[model samples]
Target: MAANPWFSWTYVVENADTLWEHTVQHAVLTVEAVAIATVIAVPLGILVSRIRWLAGIVIGTAAVLYTVPSLALFAILAPLLGIGRTPVLIGLVAYALLVILRNTVAGLDAVDPAVLDAARGLGYGPGRVLVHVSLPNALPSVVAGLRLATVSTVAMVTVGVVVGYGGLGQLMFQGFRNNFYRAEIMAATLACVLLAVVLDVAIWAGGRALTPWRERRRA
Candidate 1:
């Protein structure tokens, strides 16, 4: 393949199936982590926002977890979880919590007080006002958080290779271990970047769908 050329079409042709497998694994892991984080973070965010006192405690803990070194967190979980996707998923979710939680809380808090009061005046209960009014207004920020978390998760999926489940990371590390095979490494790296971009765009579209009124306002 032209003496290990950086762009070897032959290498890609020969390893297409393996490459596709790794890419699929990478995408799936990213999706799973982000989805789980969203489910946990969103509700926790709502609770903390309502409680006021718990906001710092919960978000601060998530922020601390975010600062824990990714490799170190993965290693710590490995002993307990026994070397697999479980530890990797847990670590990724830990990292995602801060961003998503912060965005959710901020979005909820940013909902106009006057609008909430008006909803109350119209006989809406607190729960109804929050669900029907506050959450919809906060949709953009929450989705922004999700987008950030998803892209970051895609990049972090590579870290899972240490625990034996990093999708494209497997290919990248394989190339590195095999004397820096340019084609394999480049292919994996490019795939990771492209996955992140596609996910960000997808989330942006989702956010738009959730707030079509915002689009109509712009129009």
Candidate 2:
């Protein structure tokens, strides 16, 4: 009798414990990278938008950094940071910068001129107008950028397996080594995809909640 060569429920059940751990590790790495990138990129994006000439330089630099292949970037970073999570995290953050920064700039720039004029006419200072008027209007674009960054980060985290730090990637690698353990490979792949979808949806929901006025207008 031939044995099952495809995905196996038995293997998944047996390995449930380790799989859960790897999933958590993957989520943590992705979330932390995106969070750090957002913190740095949002303020830089706002400053660049106001400065005009600096906009091209800043966005271009980030685009170049993002253009570097994931493996090549990891290889360059590995020696400096050593084999571990640090290199992976830094690489993910670098990749995320362009998307988040671009969206932030677009969002801020899209704020209606009349809205700002009204705020200023009502005695609102520049700082207050930026916080109260600009930031709120820009939330949609910022959130869209965040959604892209989070999904991209999740996919990129799999590449960290080369450095022995990829959470789900490690499992997939093991499956490959074990003579094409289809079950293991499929399980890990599905988990990563699911994580990305969940993150994207969560960001979308949060954005809608924060900007309830848009929802109200739709009704």
Per-residue CA lDDT of candidate 1, range 90-143, in tens? 999999989999999999999999999999999999899989999999989999
Q: With candidate 1 superimposed using the best TM-score fit, by how many Å does residue 40's alpha carbon deviate from the native?
A: 0.7
Predicted structure 1: lDDT = 0.92
lDDT of 2 by residue, 1-219 (tens): 125345677777999999899999999999999999999999998898789999989999999999999999999999999999999999999999999999999999999999999999999998999899999999999999999999999999999998879999999999899887788888999889999999999999999989999989899
lDDT of 1 at 100: 96
RMSD (CA, Å), each prediction: 1.1, 1.3
lDDT for 25 (candidate 1): 91
- TM-scores, all candidates, are 0.97, 0.97
* Predicted structure 2, TM vs. truth: 0.97
